[model samples]
Target: MRPQKIEEQEMLNGFAKLFKEKGYEGTSLAELAVVTGLKKASLYHRFPKGKEEMAKAVLLSINEWVEKHVFNTLTNPSLSPEERLKNGLQSIQKLYDDGNTPCLLQAFSVQSGIEVFHQLINDSMSDWVDAFTNIGLAFDLSQSAAKEKATQVLIAIQGSLIVSRGFNNPNIFINSLTNIEAMYTQE
Candidate 1:
């Protein structure tokens, strides 16, 4: 049998998707209640601190995913830097749904949980950048140069997602990944 926390995490994952789409300010307790199949009282019981707490939980889970599945791709010892970065880019692709999805961090950046949201976003992004930097280091790039490349990769991924979403075009997003790969191979 699954533990209760597993069930809770499953519910939280559901909430994460809703919050990703609607954001902290836009998503309501009523919506959460409906989506989670719980009453307001039940939600309060599970998440005693209310909506802020729920958003924190969701963001933390996302951070954990970044730490686990995403970063691990960069750290995998068997893969070359190119392969690791390519895998990481694929993870980024899936995370943003080929640019069709909204960023959960962008969603949480507004509304009631701004402080926690921003801090978690910073922590999560720093880890992502760090992973990219590590991949560059594997290719003997200097720390500063690697950091810059990492930032560029992140910017490309995020910017592509935003633009592609705005224009309803995923090809730009795909091309952005290709460009990053070529950039890496060129370096």
Candidate 2:
């Protein structure tokens, strides 16, 4: 019940960064403690189920972030489809730190991590597709076309992230976003 040294979001960010770098199987309690500036006891106090629980919390936090920043922007009734796409892509850029950060979803999809967090990962990805599909609908694409474009958009994003990191070029990611915009906006 006492005040903690680290704020909750800060603590989760610490955990998320480590997980994104190392994956759930690779991260350890000691490393998490060091990253978060918390003792093992404090971490346990917050996550009684231990590392798996922490990973689940990190995944949930990421889903919430995507929902708010990406999904909401794309679906906002107040914005034009163009405006929504622009803002949503901006949020995506920030989410990945302009391609400097690896995706937590990718990091957590390694064999062991997938085994434990499959449902959460699957649902997050489906939600992403649904959001993009909705945006495509706003652009007057048919439902099937919108869904196809949505799948392609997700592929572009995930593939570009890997290529950008591999080539040490953030522009790959930036260009992918541009291409995605064109996909929906261009005839």
Candidate 3:
């Protein structure tokens, strides 16, 4: 794969952070330009499709991040299931600590032109589900049960992020993790 130019990667990272802080409708091209240290024309030059293009880029970047960090941690061969869950929760905690930003998938889902963004979201989410399901299977769960648990974990995570941000408390995510661990233990 060809490496992205530093400027292009910088702009995409800035867009990802901003879009996480502010939903698609709330982010303006001018704000993106300011955050990226690029003129509006320059941003448009890099992303001809404008804000939508930037939003797509931001979502893709974060999806890749989640796959690498969170999902990979859960599936790491060196970590036991309990350790994997702990490491995964720690990864999430770091994300919250870094910036109490909203979930990009949920943020984009509610936007006006989100239909254009669904494919990326769906693919990323499916991959996440698969990751968790594989972990569950490794722990001796049946395939169906594993996938169901994965869905539950995903839903709990999404809800935890929304509620945690809404309540201005990061513990909601930790609490959700506890509940999920309990569920797994009961199985």
lDDT of each: 0.83, 0.91, 0.79
Off by over 4 Å in 3: 1-6
Name model 2 segments beyond 4 Å from true.
113-116
Candidate 3 per-residue lDDT, tens place, 1-187, comes to: 6543447678877887778777888888889989877788877777899888888887777777777888899899897887887777678667555326677788777764767788888887898789889778877899999999999988998888888888988778778878877777667
Clashes of 1: 0
lDDT of the structure predicted as candidate 2: 0.91
> Who wins the TM-score comparison?
2
Q: Write the per-residue lDDT of candidate 1 for residues 1-187, one digit (tens) a residue.
A: 4334337888888899899888888888999988887787888888999988998898888888877878999889998888888898888778777777777877776665467667788887888789989988887899999999999988887788778878989888989988988887885
lDDT of 3: 0.79
Winner on TM-score between 1 and 3 is 1
TM-scores of the models, in the order given: 0.90, 0.96, 0.87
RMSD after CA superposition, every candidate: 2.4, 1.1, 3.2
User: What range of 10 consecutive residues in model 3 has the weakest lDDT sum?
Assistant: 92-101
The numbered model that scores best in lDDT is 2
